[model samples]
Target: MVNLGDLNNDIPFDVLSRLPTKYMPKLKCVSKGWNRLISDPTFMKVQSQKREQLSGFFFQQKYQWCYDDITTISYIPVEKQDAELHKTVFNFLPEHVVVLASCNGLLCCRSCFPFHDSCLYICNPLSNEWLRLKWDEPNKENSFALAFDPCQDPIATPTNFKLIRVKQFETDKEALCFSFEIYSSDKGAWRKSEEICKCNNNLYKNRGIFTEGVLHWLTDGDEVLTFNVENELSWLVSVPIPANEFRSIPESCIGDSDGRLHYILVSEYGLQVWFLEDYFESRWSLKLCKTLEEMEEEHSQFLYNLRERVTQRLAVDMEPWIDPLAFKDGPLFCFTIATFHAHFSILEENLCSKFLTSCTQTSSLLHGKAIHAKFIKGSIPHSLYLQNHILNMYVKCGDLINGHKLFDEMPERNVVSWSAMVSGFTQHRFYNEALSLFVYMLRDGTSRPNEFTFVSVLQACSLHESLALAYQVYAVVLRLGFGSNVFLVNAFLTALMRHGEKEEAFEVFEKCLNKDIVTWNVMLSGYLESSCLELPKFWVQMNNEGVKPDCFTFASVLTGLASLGELNMGLQAHGQIVKSGHGGEICVGNSLVDMYIKSQRLFDGLKEKEEMAVQKKQAEVRPVGTLVQF
Candidate 1:
């Protein structure tokens, strides 16, 4: 994207691209020649990606435009070293501006002017990479957000991503869609995302988020739209929002934390959050933060619940550091400043000893046992009796070195120790190291491996792409017993598919009588990603086995069919999809449309797309869908 800039912007893009599209709307605001340039699709795409990256990262209400001396600002999450939160500086110098949205760790900012054209930029403050995107004319009123299109599964990386600015007309009744663009690193041109803007006669805000290859936002009328970068299609979705929230709060923006879509609804008193759950019939659950009036009761409840989690996390009666639930859901990104700093400080305090010493120790280290005796020798067995108290402490304090040291010194090892070691490795992505230890425990008389061990080993094998060892470990599991355990079997399937063994993988799966949805997904992915000779047969087998092919089953099978260019067989599957009512799922519909398009069935593709459109409208327009209110 950086290769060619418009003749106006002194960027390398103009000089680099075979044919550059430049000096569009922003230049058009300057002259008619520039306006003509803005009309081209290529220019729109590049500028949009760039703008999306910079135009929105994170913005707090700088309520007033106070373009005055803004000196010495340290970001909250970063400056305080909040473990779960993110912090980065604004790359551009202390020039005052307001941030709109941030996508893919890039931020966009607007200057102090009320009506004039505001500046746009894509910046990674941590990396100090900044690209300034210019816009044409004044943006007096616009409903937009910064969106990064990292096509998770790319057919091919498009020329660029886009910044979608929903331009409202005189009244809220209509809106026009314009985009600021980014240049694709892989594709050397600007690309366009043909997203349509939704209009309503009510106040709207931009809560656009970059997730799953789309930019999603709740519209002014409380509807949702998702923009797909690969196909450049803007699709409407029915985002769940609570009825009371819209009535109580004037407007809100969208944000994602910990893989869940969240909308921050602020009122006179404080901020409330609605967590959008995509599963369980697409509903939003509300969580209220504690205010002064509610603090005592909430605090009492929190402590009551916290005590239970601590006991579960810690086993023995040692003082609990972090509540066990805090680590549940795999470390939430929600914590106050004081709580986070305390957590970090606790980590540092625990790291002062030999356990800390081992972690930062070079790969070629000496006296492994000597180090263990040096820091935590005598008091450990007592610590172990304390229900893995010290282990939890080590895990929490981020003192894995000490945790491992304590772990190794134990008189007898339990399932938790091995699991912890494996988990630590998995978390850090040292898959081979984790798998080696898992094997060592199973075969080398170090520790007794359990079902959890098998799960961890299979997962590590998947990550390492260790097909040979994965099969061997599968054998070990069968010999050790618990071969038919569904969870372990699912992990085995996942590992096999990851290692590219689909047929034998299915053979292994057939032995596991207890079937679950996850197991089916792994089996299905083999057919989805690669054409195994037996996929059509397996698709039929999955149905015979009383395993209803969900949208995922159809999606994966369709992929294998598409790869083989089996249009006739593909049509047969499509007929099954219709009979099975799988066409209603958004995921299945998307895959179906793509398959149809590839098979030169535009009519079918359009028909599936229309179903998605209908689903979106029905979900978003009105929960009850009636013109009159009782």
Candidate 2:
């Protein structure tokens, strides 16, 4: 290799800009002259342009091993003749990591395991830099899309980005409308956009395709929901043809090519690509409509090799398989027989019901009803096990009418069936119905209440602040020898406290056998709710018990400190929260802000009154519907 330093200044900018970005760190170590050349502002701009022009695609492959599933990302370049796929595996990421959207070179991901709508991270795998963002918006029925403009500066380092989340709020009359919350990196906070758009609740799987300065969603109908990232406005554009005129839109998908919007349709003929030739005119030009026969003829050799490889993998069960999706990258998209088999099995004998139950997570009542009709008409047998699952599906899909109807129709009911109905009722805020069902189940005496049953009933009690009923439930728990059960006791304490029975709540908390972190959090939340000034003592006891403080613990303590206007205690707690790596949490940050504005040293009583007014205004600006409910 030629000496980089000797030719550094003389080297053509084109050649230097064409080099991969990963090589920059290594080249910077060659010599000072080379380092200066690579780091130059002009050279950086050229490099950023080259990087943007480079064609590549990113996708994830999931493999299930026993009970655990691992997802690996692959990046494939289109221009290179023989490019090796770049793989990224983040071990620290949650088991159920979902790629929400990609903007520039940064991937926006959310961790869905252990907790849904838990945390989001914006990461650049090339730079190995990532930041966890506190998502303070209500994530219910929400769709998140990431948009970044790199017109001036294309390098995917820390820069200004706007993350848009659209959430659907359904009215009692079944009318669907949406509200938006936009998170600006500049603001370092999420703001509720005043724009609310009316639309059908037919979003395609929490995914949106970003193109040209807007994010687009292909609904079940002919309408394309478009949200302008810059202006924070949303509008619907009609498709050239009605969705029903062609194949089912549910099976179709929307994507982006270059900077224009594209709709992909997979039909019996083959893959047809439609490009939007004019955004305002809503004119679409047919790009490619390759027949399956032509595709098969072209990919015959590759298909043969793929078949051989899949056969070998199935024979040994040790050989790894890869399913490449190079849709927008180039014409290298490939799928293996193993993938087909995994998908085809979804309609098989035993798996179809399970798939229906899993689809409940989508909260699509219409889809659930369709599947229910299929189950009734299909080859699947109608067993009690399947009935319980159907009941659960209806409940989870928010179809309580059908859920109750099916529950009452069950000729032979078990504990699972009753628990499913009760839990569903409790989840939908049907507290009276849930409690009445629990009582009915007990009076029947055939199916006994399980842990889930007790938890659901306790939630209902807590909702209505039913202290007398809570005591009665506690008596039943004691008689059933479940008084020592940590889960039941925790729920009981929550119910008691919500009913203003603070003394009884503490008595129950102290009588608990094994106090876990959740137990402590419940007690802390109870104390904070009651305005009890014994949090300091409780912290001492918690430390004595060797239980480390978690985010919830710190949030509760901070709430207490803020309430009392104890700036010293608040400062100490804030220090611990930052040290514990929860400083970025929205709740914690809000508490700190309240504590600061209320600090006795910072403001006199009159000043405090003024600050409180300002704080209240800020708080009013942040509506409850904007943040994750949990």
Candidate 3:
């Protein structure tokens, strides 16, 4: 057994080149000869030739400014066993850096500022080395892109790259045209490309897919704008959309997977993926067609089992009853609706409806509404199930008027129907209506209010000065023996604090037997609202109890320190933020900026003002939870 590090130049080049890319950087630091061998241009070419599969994908997480934070560059390996590679973070680049493109192992980043002369940087994340390319062009705003192909080039250099920026505006002829400035790494200067292509400037930006030695930008009109980096030519390739439900190109997403161009059509029935089989002939082949139902499991057996369990608990006699004509003015229909409601209680557990509801709630609101209309035109039993989910989707989408209307017209109601209406109202800020509906549901006594119902009701109570109402709900929770439940207790504590009942909130917090991260965060946030001095003690106690803090915890703690002007404490917390890998988080970044600025004002007197300015710029990009004041 021989140590690889101890091996001399007598070793074969094939064996030396077979070592992992990650090891190369560390091995470079081993010895002068080893470093030279690893760093040689010929050795790098050999390594590239031997590499079969892609190592991983390089992606950046947007915070505020485009800075090269260690947390920014992420390497996601295709193999799960190489999960350790995902933890490697590269942060050598300057702040306010936006990743334009990545080819081979090289990444190109530029300043994200609106319209200022900015430099573009090309870097190898594996080596953590960068080369800054000066782009001192005019200050007018331009959309930029990076294109490179190491495999296609006969001769490859580390500096082989093409930076293309398009300045698009209407010409004197009143037709849209593009002016391009191309920068070749080989040429080392910017030059205007003679090829002028007509495109919608307003709709075009740099979301180009690099494949087949070409950078492809799918235009708004389904035309692929192609630019060959090697040949330095620009042309258009028309991508003919299949005449189907998705009438426009916007309904489809263009992607490059494994060096092949792919078009993904998000149709109503399912997702259709087409690969460009022949680019010149404009030939495409259907690669995969996966329907939503096939992708999701049918929850019929689980739903039936859940229904039976609920029916056994609620029914006077523990026996099954089935009737097709149950909904037509009969007690059987009433029983059926009760059973249906039980299944709906665990609606989040139902895979099919949950998937469909998520789709509707997030992006496809119009698509969901159309599907609901189609479901309404179908048979009865299936329609009941569909109606329940549709009701949830409408409520989730902020269509409370329609949600309430649907609830009112239902002949029979269950806990799910009632809870959906109450939750929707609470989410949409219709607090009064949500509270009123909860009371009505309790009075109806048809179904017992679950944890979700109580949580939603408590949330509504917290928003208003309804301290008495919240106490009433708390009493009900105690009567139902759910007062010890951590979730409900947290909601109860939050509600108490919201109504300026800090003393009562503390009482609730002290009684929480199982205090999770949210429990600690909620109590800390409440204390911060009043500038309570007990935050430090609570933070120490949280640590002693072995509770690891998250982004929210740090944000609240940093905010408290910022307000109290505790510079030393804030710095300590900032270190913790970095250690926890939440330094780039939007909320945490805000508090850091505020804390630093305040600390500087007290001692250094704006010495770190430029750094603060960069942070503030980053804060502007990441706007969520940035309410910390100077």
Candidate 4:
């Protein structure tokens, strides 16, 4: 055995003495002295020089940024009026540079090049060591954007950062193409990939955002494209688009939903995002957001600009979203890389809870139309937002089933009071009840349906197909200037189609400016129902617009064609189906047989295909490898 005297000072820990305690018992007998050193709480604690080994020490607050200046005008949610937070300013930033986010217990900051110089530096906050990220080729008139996710795992050998830097060189200045790359400290390398972009669209006037676990940016045609940090891959998808602009500028193009690679597109629409159900697939189906225009039109207040005020008012109720259980368990929750471990009661959640409780209780306690006026009489209680939160919870819980009694008994019924009723019915699937309240809301005509109000009404009408009712809704929808909303147009079209008013449905379909695949499907189905047999031509239109048809589109068209008794066309479609490897899809195959049978093309052919499908399904479920081996 090596003597402890021979050990160097740099290796400070007692490796030999601790070795037996850490890894012995398998080799030989251990004495009580060695056992005590390993088992003694104080010795073990001092031996491992890591900070905060216990989980319940500190709580973290989350902040979101949407603009260019990281220095001035940063907005963070304050848990309380007296709540305080620390800010670490990186003065080492070269002039125009700024920091984006702190991820994985490490800090990431980016410095922009001055006057289109195109040179940029990205750094790790913990190391103070930065990299002069090399562009594939340099350009003087070029511009750059950068992001850093600092979260790291101390227990692991090394940590990971979501490092993405994009450089766009002006073609006029001398560049054939645009290039971007993501960096990984764990692998100690960078990989090259191209974003999903339109080859013939504008690349210079580009916008970028960094959040979750990737760098997200919008393309010319308004597609949301992202570069993944962990897998080093890129992806593109269509997100929800709002009809009207915030200040006539599209708010959909703002940034990534929440940075840790989570898709915030639905949340951006102002929906009550329940659970990120399947965040990995980037599949987000939210409790629909009622946009500002939908709200305005619903209450016959179609001619107003209430989006900003309504948004501000709606935001107050959701503040401080931390879990309440955290308060009793831990001193603080650590949030790194956008994931929280150990729960710290966020001051914000408490604030949000109080806001909800206050909005309702004060209304119960006061009798005037203006609750604000009463608060004005005295200092506005700290409990106002909490009262509003309680009202919202009551509404969501459908406790508003007793709302009529509650409203009559209420000290006052202001806008929020009516809103609570409208929201309550909608949340509880009391659509007719919700609609009745809308009529009542407009009876006196003082209160108007704001953004949140209208979206609920429009969604309620989507499944109910009453053309006259929809047209009336449309008159208001357009009067509120929501004619541009792709989603609402869907509701408008569905109403017409159900009433067999194919002509009117087609009119609105053609007028939509932002046509995604869903829009195309609606139009294609309408054209087919009207026997405008040239359905495939619309696929050309979709292709020309650069919208890719998924397998669902194929299923929709094939079902339509089979219904038309077009055997030759069906045969051609079958060829396309087989070519696209969708021949065996259940809907496609079933529709193919149904089409053939209806067309009287060949009855035997249909039966044989069904048998083959059944055989295939059976084969898929019963593995051949499971059979006994000789």
Tell how far residue 170 is off in model 2, in angstroms: 49
User: Model 1: residues >4 Å from true position, as ranges?
Assistant: 1-301, 304-413, 440-446, 463-465, 497-503, 528-532, 565-587, 606-630
Writing each residue's lDDT as its tens digit, candidate 4 over 324-423 gives: 2233211111111012210111223342343334324322211111222323344234343434444565565446644455555555456676777676
In TM-score terms, candidate 2 sits at: 0.47
Each prediction's total of clashing residue pairs, residues at least 3 apart in sequence or on different chains, is 40, 5, 7, 43
- Give Cα-based local distance difference scores for all models: 0.54, 0.67, 0.64, 0.48
| Residue-by-residue lDDT tens digits, candidate 3, 508-619 | 8888888889999988988888766878778878878989899899988887887777778777877777788786676776677667776665343343345556666877
Task: Give the true-structure RMSD of model 3.
Answer: 17.1
Question: For candidate 3, what is the lDDT?
Answer: 0.64
Sliding window of 10 residues with minimal summed lDDT for model 2: 621-630
Model 4 has a clash total of: 43
In order of lDDT, best first, we have 2, 3, 1, 4
TM-scores, all models, native as reference? 0.39, 0.47, 0.45, 0.35
Angstrom error of the Cα, residue 314, model 2: value is: 20
Best prediction by TM-score: 2
lDDT of 4 at 278: 38
lDDT of 1 by residue, 1-630 (tens): 554444454333353222322333234476554444544455455454332211111213122224432222224222122232222355353445556656655566655453455566655555556655555564635445655543331112322445656544343444544343444544534444445444443334444676656667666655565566556666455545543553233334666654567665433233356777663255677755433234224444222233332223322111111222232221121222112222221222232232323222312112222223333534233333332444544544355676677667777777767777776676667787787778667665756788877787888888887878878888888898888799888888888777677767878777778788778888878666665566777767777777767788788888777766777877888888889987777777777788889988899889889988998777673322111100
- Residue 88, candidate 2: C-alpha displacement in angstroms: 28
Stretches of candidate 4 exceeding 4 Å from the true structure: 1-429, 444-447, 459-465, 525-546, 571-589, 596-630
Positional deviation of residue 599's Cα in model 3 after best superposition, in angstroms: 3.7
